[model samples]
Target: MDAAARDAQGGLEWRVTVPEGATVKVEHEHGAVARAWAWLLACMVMVRSTVAGFAKRVWKIAVDDPRKAVHGLKVGLALALVSVVFYTRPLYDGVGGAAAIWAIMTVVVVFEYTVGGSVYKCFNRAVATASAGVLALGVHWVASKTGELEPVILSGSLFLLAAAATFSRFIPTVKARFDYGVTIFILTYSLVAVSGYRVDELAALAQQRLSTIAIGIFICLAVCVLICPVWAGQELHLLTTRNMEKLAAAVEGCVEDYFAEEPARPAQVKSDGYKCVLNSKASEDAQANLARWEPAHGQFGFRHPYSHYAKIGAAMRGCAYCVEALNSCVGAEVQAPEHVKRLLCDVCTRVGTQCARVLREASSSVATMVSSKTLDFAVADMNTAVHELQGEMRTLPSMLTVKLAETTSLMDTMPLFTVASLLVEISARIDGVIDAADALATLANFKQVDNDDDDKKRETEMKVHPLNESDTDDEASPENQITKV
Candidate 1:
């Protein structure tokens, strides 16, 4: 049934219509043999796709983080062991069925990338669980002893325990690392104590929970440490090295973007150059902390000199600050005078390239845990480049001063002045970075010092500059900031 009507604007509108007898028909007309062949072909196609999809997904997961596969395997094995022990009559009767659940949770909580972190967490969790179980048993016994004080004893004990645990979390030292353990302790205590009120087997329940958690922790520790273990320190060192490379790349990119005669490309902004350096600070800090928790092994000893890691981090921040300033000077909003642009281009070609190259060397050197003499040469070249940039910047003020003297109004010269100021600031920041690099080199024992006073003086000068607060921190000292190269 089709119909036409006049629209509001006085135009005829045709409406979609289906005939009364019209039907959507999907008919299969293949003969018996042909239909069987079609069905077989469709099944083959579906099977092939399913298999391919499964294989592709497996590859993707493995490629993303091969360690993830290892972790998964470890978890599975730990859980399986718990299940096997739980199903066996003797073991299951000895500990209680609930022991298996606690064992599973232990495996979930104790696994960490570094053996040190895992062990540390395992110990903390095991101790916390044991302590909580004991306390819950004591609370249950005390409540049972009281004739009419069961509710009061249980509720009041919970309130006190909850308040104390919550207060401990607010303590700065505990909150950073052990907060999770504290939270689990509180939860386990509450569950055990509260649930024990109805169940007559409070002691048995507590014992089972503690035993299961202990077993799980032991399994995780053994598997993580003895197997293909990954060290957080190694990861941290690698991250630091990568960040160095990223920092160098960022500097070069920012220099190119700022001075290029052509318009900035969309792809340029999205590249790893700027974003990598910009987002590195917090990630690097966290990784370093995790690394610190890792036990000394391989190249690292009990007295592993990880303090140098802090120095390298600070140096990266110094480099990052300069790079960020350079990044800010990009885009159509800012423009420099023709002569100033030429000067910048020349500086970038000479100094910026050297910075990136040196940083790349430093990154490699750090990863290898070896000091390179090349950093000294890089520092020398960087010094020359900095001086050259300083000379170019000095000319700007002279030129601007002349213009200001000749013309009463400073408006025309202000934009160029701002550009010159940024260049000068950039030079100043590079000066700090150079000093930081030297400091880093010295701390890594790569650079021998007859007298530390000279390095100290240079660092003092860097600290005076107000380009950023990174240089003012105690760790911003020359020794606290370093790179391998």
Candidate 2:
């Protein structure tokens, strides 16, 4: 016989009594309720962790750029202003629920973070909507006149207009500025053409949509321009200036790391700092395009030669490429001998430092909106450093011939040669950057520094007080030293 009984621990146990008084007991497994509780606990933990992580990311974003938070609020304000149309009786009657939906949709689509971006999209949407509506009305009139071929006429018009608009998107100039407009044109045209077939009040429908969308666009533009406006022109100017500084820092860092007694570790190499310049082309182009839509704001005037920034960025990237190659030399496995590096160390460092100084001065000129006379001086110093480097290079063969004496392989010297050559090329590229910056200054009417008087006074002082040997030595530091070998 088998019987069920509760054990001392209060768990269910099954006991079987056999002949000769032998007994066996089986413990009960846990019930489904316990498993359900465990699963529920796991789900709670996962949900809690997911929520915490999402909140952390949101907080980080909001903190990193408070402008993003402000932009969000501006968007909300625009939406709220447009939503009043639905609540007011007159507006509700004029713009029906169906049309009011378009107003809301327009606000959502047209409101951008930057004032220029919002203006660009709003203008595009309005013009595209108006143009498409008028064209649709004309096509509808023609289709109605032809009774038998009405459907054919409508379909043909749709095909031709849609094809033309889509093809226009492939054009570079059109795609950059008017791509959004073309897309909206196609959507508005298709809606009116297809719906006009079934509905008699096509003109009223188109008018309601156009008027409401215009209202939405007006509200969006007002909010974007008035509420803590972020100007694309200013952003682009700052970005270009910041990139120049980064280029300078990258050049300095690369040279420093390369000539360090120990080879740069992977971590040091990874943080080369030139990556920002390499990846900034897209952002620069986008900002330049949007900036053209903005009116005069802050230091940037109307039609403020924003295109010159693209040229400057291109020149910076060219220099950045050389810096990247120089960085690679820092980690090369086959290094030049200690003596070979020592031979060119002072000249290389001097040239690199001067290149960085030139970049920094150019960047400062751009940032301050001043045509810096000091920038000319910096360029002159850079040129002198380059001459000194060339002089060192001329003596390098003879010096290496004596020191190496068939002891060093070609592979061992290649890294040093690459670093030296890149530094020289980088110095050449700095001239392009300087030229672009100068052009921008000229076009933008940057404030010119009057330093002739200061220069003459300094020259007079220098002529009166001659430098002693100690003073000459102090002035002829490693950076100012002209090395022959």
Candidate 3:
């Protein structure tokens, strides 16, 4: 799920590149050495896990909580130690299989860094990885039994798997579908190795490589878990929070399209209702600000839990409802010929406004508190949280656009304004939090520097007068004092 990064369009997520670099190369190369490679790589890993560490470091930097970086680094180092001790044992002993495993581990760490969102975290990653490992093991067994890793067959299987993964989400639950899809891809890859396309030796070699891969996973898993202590979730939370803003921005783009188009009667449109509002496609003009939910990149959000993704998911759902309503009401009558019917503006005044208010409350809920409350709790304090009680709150402008669009569509007349003003309000609201966060982070940084400077100044004075002895005025008064510096 973390692999599902955002495409340039930013609508849905896509796969991210594996962060393979010097460390991964060196790890694999070291593993390949005749002997003592593990020790050598251990002394100095092939790769320094920079790419792997980038996301976390960036998150901390953004939140002005660099101190967390130290803890993260410590955890990473410990995981590395564990990996070196466990997975690299066979290689260190005689197999001299160090390089490939090291490379894979580095790759895994990089994947961890790049991954984002709750679906990835929905099921524990350890569980996912262990399951994937078992799957890989199983696939390898199948290959051994079948004596076939056919290119055509594997390719077809992969295609079907991808297609199925995407479409199957319509049934059962989204989380299960996503996890199953992930397992499919993972198992498919595992089967490739086990299918004996080449021979048993290759399978044997693959098995060894797989074991080494497991070592890297252990390190990555351990390291990933350790970051929470350092930043206290401040940094990672902000990163996802920014991603949420982007999602809101995406929602706004649709609303803007509604406004930018021709204005007409609010009531005489030809559509059925507000269902069209949920259209995932944004206008072609929105080049810069189009992609909404881009947070699905690598291990970016893996440090946190699923709650972050829930916000994004909520936003998406809100968008969906807005779209559905739009389909039903797009191009509807704004002014009644016989009587004054409630227009889109009224909905804006009520639902969207209410959502904004709820979102605002949600945003402010945390600025005053410092408890171990869940992120969902913080989200509940927002205006959109009105949906919590009613099953659907509409702080989003697109939803209004969708409804208005549907109304006008049905009536065969465009409204004076199909777009709602709430998008700007939502954007403003999100920006408000972002601005406050930036300011707070800056202030935090400044205070940290100030304190560090004060500590240093104190330290300098300590060096000049390091003695901890209690001062006594009675020690011969002025005669006891030394005049020398």
The candidate maximizing TM-score is 2
419-471 per-residue lDDT for model 1 (tens digits)? 44554554455455455545645554553434476565445544442222123
Compare candidates 2 and 3 on lDDT and give the better one. Answer: 2
**lDDT of every predicted structure (CA atoms):** 0.65, 0.83, 0.39
Q: Root-mean-square deviation of each candidate, in angstroms?
A: 10.2, 6.2, 27.4
Q: Runs in model 2 with CA error above 4 Å?
A: 1-43, 197-200, 269-271, 402-411, 451-453, 457-485
Pitting candidate 1 against candidate 2, the one with the higher TM-score is 2
Which ten residues in a row are the worst by lDDT in model 2? 476-485
Give the TM-scores of the predictions, in the order they appear.
0.71, 0.86, 0.32
Error of 1 at 82 (Å): 2.9
Error of 1 at 60 (Å): 4.1
Evaluate residue 467 in candidate 3 and report its C-alpha lDDT on the 0 to 100 scale: 19
Cα TM-score of candidate 3 = 0.32
Please state the error at residue 238 of candidate 3 in Å: 7.7
In candidate 3 the C-alpha lDDT for residue 157 amounts to 50
Candidate No. with top lDDT: 2
Can you write out model 3's per-residue Cα lDDT over 378-465, one digit (the tens) per residue? 2332333223212222322354456655443433222323333333234334434434433433332311223565455444433343
Give the per-residue lDDT digits (tens) of candidate 2, residues 208-309: 888899889888888898879999989999999999988898898888888889767765633366788899999999999999999888888878999999
Which regions of candidate 1 deviate over 4 angstroms? Answer: 1-61, 113-117, 142-146, 197-200, 269-272, 303-311, 337-340, 396-485
